[model samples]
Target: MDYQFKLLRQSRQNLLRFTEQFTLEELNEVPEGFNNNIIWHMGHILVTQQLLCYKNAGVPCRISDEIINQFRKGTKPEALVPEEEVTFIRKRLTQTPSLLEEDFRNGLFGEYNEISTSFGNTISNIEEAVVFNNIHEGMHFGYLLALRRALTKTV
Candidate 1:
């Protein structure tokens, strides 16, 4: 579990670095042929983690319902995310994992409901959800890389 948390932290750090290079416009730009943008991916990562780990466990999620509505699966960016909200998301990208670790250590997730992911995997426990989340985040990280490359080419 410690190793999983470590990987998650490192992955998010890489994401933060990937996002820091883009201006707000670039972060918000949905390049042709792409359904979403870099910041949307980042926000989705945050929202998905909360849903998978806390919400599925029958625990209250840390993020707002509005955030869940905006960034959850099947949702595209409806408007340009302000730099302020981006900043909040960036902070949570790091903070949420630490809080998750603490909550896990304290045994806050004793009742995870089995949930089927869009990727066809069924997560049956909090531990499995956390591990799956790392994979999910990595997938989005790849999307972020591809989006950045596309955005850069158009610049």
Candidate 2:
């Protein structure tokens, strides 16, 4: 397994477990002034997995175009996705890491295009993007924690 993939899996599992503590209402709550709900964040992470791996690897995504469009890099959270769909999304999240590994092994990786975000600098390879996304996901994990607090009125 690639070290980057391992990190992504670890973070992803942590995110899922963290999410499990919340009720559906809590997961769906946007919290005043926030851009998205917990469900959106979770979906976004999965969407990012494809964008950073399969799409960048020069292979088409195995997930649906509608999902890709909804969760892609810049998509916002205001879009309404049902709670049931969100729950199903969590299950689907389990399947992406292996697909990423497949892309890596099949030499499906393509040259990195520049990603302009808080991370800064142009990435020249998929490995760097993989590493960067770990940090990116962590940042969102922080948001998830905040959302949990906001929705549940708990610390």
lDDT of 1 by residue, 36-124 (tens): 99999999999999999999999999999999999999999999999999999999998999999999999999987998888999999
Question: Where in model 1 is the C-alpha error above 4 Å?
Answer: none
lDDT per residue (tens digit) for residues 1-155 in model 2: 47888887888788888888877767767887688888888988887777766676566877888888887767776656777788678887877777677777887786666566556665567787677678778998998887876776643
lDDT of each: 0.95, 0.77
lDDT for model 1, on a 0 to 1 scale? 0.95
As for candidate 2, its clashing pairs are none
Clashes of each: 0, 0
